[model samples]
Target: MIVHTAEVVRYVTAPAVTFEPLRDGASRGLLDHYLATLAVATGPVGLTRMIASTADMTARLLDFAPDALRRIGADAIIADSAEPSGPIIAQHLGVPYVISVTGLPLLEEENVPPPFVGWRYRSDRLGRFRNRGGYRVSHFLMRPIASTLHRRRLTWGIKDADQPLAYVAQCPRILDYDRQNLPPNFHYGSPWRNSPAPLLDPPNGDKPLIFCSLGSLQGARKKLFAIMAKACAEIGARAVIGHGGGLTPEEEASLPGNPLVRAFWPQETLLRLCSAAVLHGGFNTVLDALAAKVPIVAVPIAFEQPGTAARLAHFRVARVISPQRLSVATLVKALEEVVHDPTYRDMASRLSVAMEAGGGASGAAVIVDAALSKLP
Candidate 1:
């Protein structure tokens, strides 16, 4: 059974999956504000606001989720990394839970920067110092969430050690920086997605195809989509844009290259035919593009996107551009490099092989089952 927000019901199409929506009045509005904050957040200030909003949402969840889960009689909980209330609620219900990191994992190491930063992995003394500083800032921003969790734990008589039974991330270990301190229960799993159905009629065009997406949250940035469309046109490629229902009909009609614009699409199907991709550096999209052996031009906007883009650059599979510096000219240059160079595609192919070996959702399910088996 899935305990989610009411808005999530539309996406829950699996026949066997049952869901219960948290009856919190403030959850939707708070979540909207959080996403809005992430769309334009640049540094510490924006991150603080995001954390504050999350704390507010967590409080709401704490007020209602325990009762909801009790009513449903959930034996075990699988929680998204973004939801901090999950572990606390699981403890309140005395149920084993798993942490599902659908995006970049937030684990901190001295040699690796926090997930919010775009800094590359560095192991040298100065690099470690920089990473430590970044983590300090991250901790500072997360204080609100920490305080909320602490208060709730105290109220519910839960321990400070709110550890999950298993911590599974969709990020392939090969794509992440070396980590010597991962928890024993942590597993690097592949992207969680169903097999793609064959496209009834694949796109037919002489021009090299480029897939562009900003993901669901930031897909409403019409100006950014315009730049992507213009850049693709300048490079003599066809751009297929998926805005995730974030665009209006009139706005979609104005994009350059006479691009095909849609609210959603079969991403994997289209990506298999593309030479390169333009993205907001969302982890899932990056994984999908790599799985399809497509190189990327990443314009990271907020959240863990910059960190994901940094990893892509580290692997030489993508060119990372800051959203602040994004423009038709800059995007065109990045696209040209990724499209014309074979090295990017080659590296992506290598990672694709590694991801296949990492065992996708099935591998994660194995870890989860093992964890739950040990529970009393």
Candidate 2:
């Protein structure tokens, strides 16, 4: 039987890991949930970067003891296939590794340019231009640093791990990026299709409905939650929100007593029902919105998020707002434009058709099967 396993390899510490840090029980719980899914399909194995225990020890062992990987009996190692920790371990195990690009591919060497540069590169012409230059420089310097950290903590030796054979991106083919340069084996795995059914029935109201979310990871911040709340208030449209990682209990409790606000609306359901959305421009949210044919207003926070927001603006599928300038007025204006303007909705709907045509579960399954084929 072919054994399949996932390891965490990228952004396990600085950003992705920090949100819930698998080291902390919160992140670990999420990891466990996904691992359980994989376990049902393939079998479970430990995913590290859990709470950021000095991965140094784990790396050293994998670098030296190829047998450790063998002991796991995994035929293929999928990195970020579950989380971002697998590819590093797979690299040292001298086994085949597949990098999973669940979010917009942000790493340059990986050829996955940050999603939505069309917007990010233009937000503030001068400031963004300078920031882009700095980001490039920073990325150059940090590649090795990131690589070193991966080597030291995930493998027996940094020098021993081989770069992965392919990556499975979560984006749909409609949002096909220009930067992913890996082998043809690199694949895109869409989670929207993989997700459960829409959380609620499409809104039946005649007035335009607006849905708001910050994706799942960054939904915990009170300030951002407040911004979303205020935006919904100003729009005066029917609204649904999935707090994701953005709201506090108190904040949720305090939501204005308007039918417009909800703490946990199924995003896909709401997107399908809403006339427009105001979101953080996360890859998942953007793709899901596009698939649902809903126009968007993106307020990006960090990393590839800004780029993703920028792309929606460039495509005219959504309005892109800088986090610094995302005032209630701007949101109200953008919301009105998307809701009232036929052009925006038309563009979004056409893109939604394209996104729908781009296969989802089948694509991921194809990749998974191919990875298995390479195994002994």
Candidate 3:
């Protein structure tokens, strides 16, 4: 299977950095961004139109590629989400394709709305209930129509009928993923997060270190930063925050203290030397901390975070404090608990061992390659 992956990419600075849009306000024109980025990858031209979902966009793709489709031939395309147009093109080209759900809820589950909805908007019991209805609607109505369109057009002369699989989840078996009555073909690949950056070995620098970040989606708000600054100061921990979300000039200038506060740090790299992490509880951050064997003081901003926090509590690995109801006192206390309490550290250590047991990238790569091998 020659796989083609369709996912969103954004460069707040330059040169185009590709990241999952699991956070809020990260991508304004997602479809446009994906269509542009997809062309950058090597693939067939006619199929690229199907990937872009624009017959016109195919022309632009074709101009760059003289007889690209004829040269590449038919290969399997694995789309990360229904959001991407690869399936549409795959159908038109009669080529095999797969859908890869990058996040938890988007993974092969019945009756769950997009997790991105949670970060962008408020969710409740009623909202969740409504999502169930909407899930049913899309699963029954929209999915079939789109799937039919894809199959009819592109898959006409496709050699392998069963080559294109349904859902490929990027979940590690080490984590507590809900694996119920999933089909044999419904696969869980290795975590892409396993490509952890090389640890910088930040010299442990003499103070109790706390890794702090509100997440890239939720940028550095002065109020939140101020509160965190005060809390970290009280707790006597050096703070390091990431600037992935693109802070403004004033925001950059206004960060509390220089020697103690860092503007940016590689997440996995920092996790190794830090005593504790104070993050907005994005799934990636949470999983990275678990992989690094570090305790977390999760201040969930929205959506799956609350559920993620609940899951952490269930796992007995970390503590959850809602940013909405959280105070400097509560933040300070949570930090103290994670930093001082042996239990939190022990649980984190245990979970970390479990996470590492999967063997990171190599482990995940095996599952993905197996699925692809079965395709043709």
Candidate 4:
């Protein structure tokens, strides 16, 4: 497994798995700054800043990954969709590669809005025009990474070919907006997990339990946690917060409602016990929540979060409150509505069933095997 030095500590690899750390890359500080920038940025400007922040990291991956992968004699590559360099490196190395959509799939379709924006899915001519315009803007913003890839491809004497052997997303088709232009090789898969997570005992008390998580990347927002806690408290719900090591002990203690705030927890286990979830629209957590048949209240902060939240709303499984507009009262209203309404729970349950039918990691593996089988 190849990953950044900072992320190496997060994984618990099996005996057969070896982690190859990419060193001297983006520092923790730079990554934090990038996340911070995205917290306040929105629209096309936010997208531009996001691409600009990752320019150096993209260059480093292009410089290091091809040689490292070649040395390892890797026969096939499974590249994260978020990392564009992966497909390029595989092309340069002449290896078959599969693109894994860990977050929202970045595939461009005229009827689908770009993943960064919260625009609703539209199939009309005007909507298609708008969607195309969004892609053009995204393509323009991506020139920095594109330039790096072009230079590397030239140096390696490889022609431009970014298409993957297969594409699998960590989302079920029902959770996403309808897409008419997906590649034939594209497959909708389930969230990757080793096994079915065992359900945990619900927290003691009759107060409706609500799981609140901002995921690892955006968990550091103390104010957001505080707002969620306050809203849950007002709604007479117990807020179980997993901030992913983002909060200091003092900060955690300072949150309202004396909410059960931990740096980490068995999220799937907690979701099973919760009546509703308050999320930052992180895809993995959203999947976990839906899998538990729990309704949601989404506060989208950055990246493809808004788009994810929009889908949740489109399906009537969640209520979205943009971070810029989020507050204790707004969250309280969303939380109460989701918890008390049977429709939200019903929709979530339906999606959960659909998600299971699509199959999880095992289904994704089958697609990968088939793709590789087609390779020479």
Pairs clashing in candidate 4? none
Q: After superposition, how far is residue 175 of candidate 1 from its true place, in Å?
A: 0.5
Index of the highest-TM-score prediction = 1
**Model 4 TM-score, 2 decimals:** 0.92
What digit string (tens of lDDT, one per residue) describes model 1 on residues 120-238?
A: 78899999999989988778778888899899989989877678998999989889898889898889988888888676777777988899999998889999899999889899988
Ranking by TM-score: 1, 4, 2, 3
Candidate 1: where is the Cα deviation over 4 Å?
25-48
Residue-wise C-alpha lDDT for candidate 4, range 1-376, written one tens digit per residue:
6544355544646665676655555566655676666555556787677677677677877877666676667899999988778887888777889999988878888888999778887789998999899999878878988888788888888876868889998888888788888888889877887665564554788888899999887778899999999999998988999998889999999999969888988888788889999998999999999999999998887878889998999999999998889998899888889988899999999999998888788889899999899876
lDDT of each: 0.86, 0.59, 0.58, 0.84
TM-score of each: 0.94, 0.70, 0.66, 0.92
lDDT of 2 by residue, 311-331 (tens): 677667888877688777777
Segments in model 2 whose C-alpha atoms lie over 4 Å from true places: 1-71, 81-85, 107-136, 140-147, 150-163, 176-182, 188-192, 198-206, 245-250, 257-263, 374-376
lDDT of 4 at 112: 87
**Model 3 residue 216 CA deviation in Å:** 2.3
- Which candidate leads the pack in lDDT? 1
